[model samples]
Target chain A: MRRLCVHTITTKPLSLEECLVEFPKRGVSGITIWRQALEGRDLGAVARQTREAGLDVVSLCRGGFFPAATATGRQAAIDDNLKAIEQAHAIGAPLIVLVCGAVPGQPLVESRKQITDGIAAVLPAAEKAGVKLAIEPLHPMYADDRSAVNTMRQAHEICDALGSPKSVGIAVDVYHVWWDPELKEQIDHAGKTGRLHAFHICDWRTPTIDLLNDRGLMGEGCINIREISDWVDATGFTGHREVEIFSNRLWSGDQREFLEKIAASYAQLYA
Target chain B: MRRLCVHTITTKPLSLEECLVEFPKRGVSGITIWRQALEGRDLGAVARQTREAGLDVVSLCRGGFFPAATATGRQAAIDDNLKAIEQAHAIGAPLIVLVCGAVPGQPLVESRKQITDGIAAVLPAAEKAGVKLAIEPLHPMYADDRSAVNTMRQAHEICDALGSPKSVGIAVDVYHVWWDPELKEQIDHAGKTGRLHAFHICDWRTPTIDLLNDRGLMGEGCINIREISDWVDATGFTGHREVEIFSNRLWSGDQREFLEKIAASYAQLYA
Candidate 1:
């Protein structure tokens, strides 16, 4: 019943060893590993260490950036994603969250087409590995370079384009989608289609200083986290309310204390 | 054949007199007046001065912040908007742009309801003064404190909720809406309903330095302005393609040079 998951990047200051030791001790039931956190480490051993501590490996932090100007660049991205699928398999993560990319100055429609193609290219590998690929729709501010898919509707369209394969789904992030007018309907639709593979939570600061690194902790900013949770929950998504925060401010602090605060905030929001 | 208008705030360094003189010399044929540009000057005299410069008064800069925590706060916003209507009337401006506000922690649904009520409360004055109210949906970045209307569809929905009054219309700004997947449909719908009252342009720069003031100049960033403009024109729109950029970088330079650059950019994109 304890379903709180924290992204490894949320505590960037902590080493993988630190996370393995600290996360389970905090009563946190799950961990999503960022690829950077495993650099030069033995992933199979890392998987054993993580599960040995009674923490579920919820997902790999990311595996996308599919839009590129050159065919070679795009193919490289697909290769990287295939490698991510292999890593996810090794680490025993059942899912890979994708920040499907956008190229600056490239047409989003073309980038979208490329994204659809990229995902399709990797679908067979994902299915072979039994790894679900969750397309994370980033905030629109990131439309210039981070993603072309900036809404759940577009994500659904991409899924439909890919034939709604069981291995392909969506990752709902509150920081990216809280302002959407069509959120309730989109969530219900994602649920009805049984493609809501992941859920992420964070708050939007009033004067978000940096688009990439200025996320607010829950209850510290303007998002109605509880209401959004209720909407996601209404769709029968009884999975990890995964905490995926990227904050320069939060990262510089005592990461253990910061994560304790995470537990506190998640508990208070869901209380 | 000149179809370019410039927002006064785009040249923040310039006085109203400077805009009246310089905008036309650069082949910019229209201007949208921000309330701050008027200061304590006589509105009627300012209107006469603008006309004397052979410039069309496109619209009053803004008048909407409907959502507040209290009934008293909402009433105060309405009172301010009514004053804006009077100013628009006195200045001979035919339209008043509405930013239709949001509260930091308030549910957007409640803010939307308040915005609808607030607009209805002002419809009679707007109708009497013959000033159309153009709902300019702010970008999702501003949804925390600027406006709950973040999409053209939402703007159209508000117009519909208000019974599609002749005085209520939507302003399409490419900066806020270029990322929308439903953009073409929304534009076509607004046109079909005869609610597309205004069109504005700018671009989205990669590595956008600041949220509030780092807007890209025309053709300086990634928006397919010509494509979007074609969409607007296809809907039988013949109004000025207003340049409403908010760039601290551009404003800090010589404003005259900036205006010329804007003219050049417009010519390149639209010619």
Candidate 2:
């Protein structure tokens, strides 16, 4: 419970203000803020209020979509990522998760090259702002149009390509990576290289209806969450086991119930 | 087009009889028979009819669900697979493709071990029947409940574990292995090892709506089918370039039209 964090997008129905008020009440120790939830809000005040409620700002939800069809499109992504870095600084989030982008028809190797370049371009901004960037390797299902970095090895390679910059690392998300046979080895490598920056939890539903938003709660699906968490913890990672689910089913429900369910899942799987 | 083959399920609405008559007419030189398409038919007669229609029997569509929670279930799978070997022999399909199974909640490692054992058990019958078993590595999206074998490397490992038998090899499906970063290297290894039994081609739709049935025709989606086919060709694989798709949208339309589209796509891409 002490290591539990909940991403604001997990309960998409809840506002950041609502989360700042309710997350602490539910014994959630940390909150990772998605940019959308900061819509028309004072970033500094949200940070201050979250802190006042005794919640640590876990990380900013996302800040990468670096691969694009054109140089202009790629530049635009870099500009947006720069803005995200500034936002993360204002919100007192020490890290930003990256869903490194891919173009639909582009070769993944090229997309990956672009992703490495994009991260390098944004690294200076992140370093200057003291906001670490975590590349979240998405499932290969998203390898077409989402992140080209669909494995921890690919993310690690990108970080390695960028010269193992202290500001860049990998985010291990179980929903995306639990199916990987190389998961434990890669997780071990990430930890050994000090590149395992974050751990996100959710389950891969057996009949995952939607590719993007059908993530199941911890116990609802078959992911070996406890084992993966143990691996993360074995690395001496005392960071938040962030609950970062994107589920239309759970989001449509009462967010209090969902948050409580997340807490219960965290307690069962981690505590 | 001379090297072109199509799986029966690629046009799910078509009966085996319809495909037998239609595929050769469309200049698809071969037909891969799905077990479901053979219901209530005389296997020998179908084989004769397929040959009489000037179509070579490429392979049997599938014969594996090799992992189960219960020993009884696992035995049942092996038994059914043995029957599939007999059927493939009876149908003159010299090969049987295996979509190795996974139990949802079972640890994948355990499931993989069971998969290896199950294949070993079925190997004797396959050898006796003179029907080769091609281990088809399903996409990782299916790794939860559909297949524990989700990469060529895993399939190769299983083959190696079984002492690299001549009776067992790999079925490379582009739709399944396209996103794999190790695809080209693994394919090269498979070819050099003489384990490349079959090559399957299908387009992966951008917003792949359904995990099971939302495959696209060649030009309809993002997969580099020609490039993958070229890699297979580079290995001197003169065997059929099999078009295997499962599209509900295409199935709901006129199947003849769909078949024509497949033909056009093949000619445009491969010819």
How close is every model to the real structure, measured as TM-score?
A: 0.98, 0.99
Clashing residue pairs in candidate 2 are none
| DockQ of model 2 vs. true complex | 0.80
In model 2, state the lDDT of residue B181: 93
- Give one digit per residue, the lDDT tens place, for model 1 in A148-262: 9999999999999999998899999999999998898999999999999999998999888887898989998999888888988999999898998999999988998998899
Going through the candidates in order, their DockQ values are 0.74, 0.80
How well is each residue in A183-263 modelled by candidate 2, as lDDT tens digits? 999998988888889999989888989888999999989899999989988987889989999998998899998888888
Model 2 — TM-score against the truth? 0.99
- What TM value does chain A in model 1 reach? 0.99
* DockQ of prediction 1: 0.74
| Candidate 1: regions farther than 4 A off | none
> What lDDT tens digits, residue by residue, belong to model 1 across residues B1-271?
2889999999999999999999999999999999999889999899899999999999998999999999999999999999999999999999999999999999898999999999999999999999999999888988999999999988988999999998899999999999888899999998899998999999888889888889999888998888999999999999999999998889889999999899998988877
